[model samples]
Target: MSGDAVLDLAREGIWVMIIIGAPVMVVGLLVGVVIALFQALTQIQEMTLVFVPKILAIFVTLLLSLPFMGAILSGYMARIADMIVTGG
Candidate 1:
């Protein structure tokens, strides 16, 4: 393919990656900030307190978001397949 085509594909790949990862990252960030604030307020300062909840929250968020993520990836793959079939 031409350089422009390659670059377009690369850009789409990067955006797809970002779209897939954004939910998990955002959830984890929000949870971390809340946990940090709680720790600050209560002065608990326990390391596990911070990690366990964030991990669990992220896992749950991932589970909930799996269908949407799958759909996005599947759509991208389908597009790529179509492009290949069309010799683009």
Candidate 2:
């Protein structure tokens, strides 16, 4: 592949990675912030208090977004395959 095509593919892969990961990461961040706020307001500064909810939220987000992620990955793979076949 040409340098330009390689760079374009790399850029696209990065975008796909971001798109696939954004939902889970966002949910996790929101959950962590909320938990931190709760801890602050209630004065419950337990170190392990943050993990469960954040994990659960991230898990649910991933489950909900699984199909979308799969579609994105499949589309990327198809493009990669096409490029390989075409020797681009």
Candidate 3:
């Protein structure tokens, strides 16, 4: 394939990755922020306090978003497969 085609594929792959990962990341970020705020207010400076909630929130978000993520990934895979088949 040409350089342009390769670059386009790379760009699309990156976008797909971002899209698929956004939900869990966003959840983690939000949970971490809230936990930080709570810790600050309560003066509970425990290092481990930051991890569990963020992990649980991210995990729940991942579980909830699994189908959507899967669909996006499958679509991307299909597009890549098509591009390969059609000799992009």
CA lDDT scores, all candidates in order: 0.94, 0.94, 0.92
Which pairs of residues clash in candidate 2, taking residues 3 or more apart in a chain or in different chains?
none
lDDT of 1 by residue, 3-88 (tens): 88878989999999999999999999999999999999999888889889999999999999999999999999999898899888
Query: Candidate 2, overall lDDT?
Result: 0.94
Per-residue lDDT of candidate 3, residues 1-88 (tens digit): 8999899989999999999988988888889899999999999999999998888888889889999999999999999899899998
Name the lDDT value of residue 43 in candidate 1: 94
Per-residue lDDT of 80 in model 2: 99
* Model 2 agreement with the true structure over 9-66: per-residue lDDT tens digits: 9999999999998998889889999999999999998999999888888888888899
Predicted structure 3: lDDT: 0.92
Give the winner by TM-score. 2
Of candidates 3 and 1, the better by lDDT: 1
The number of clashing residue pairs in each candidate reads: 0, 0, 0
Number of clashing pairs, model 2? 0
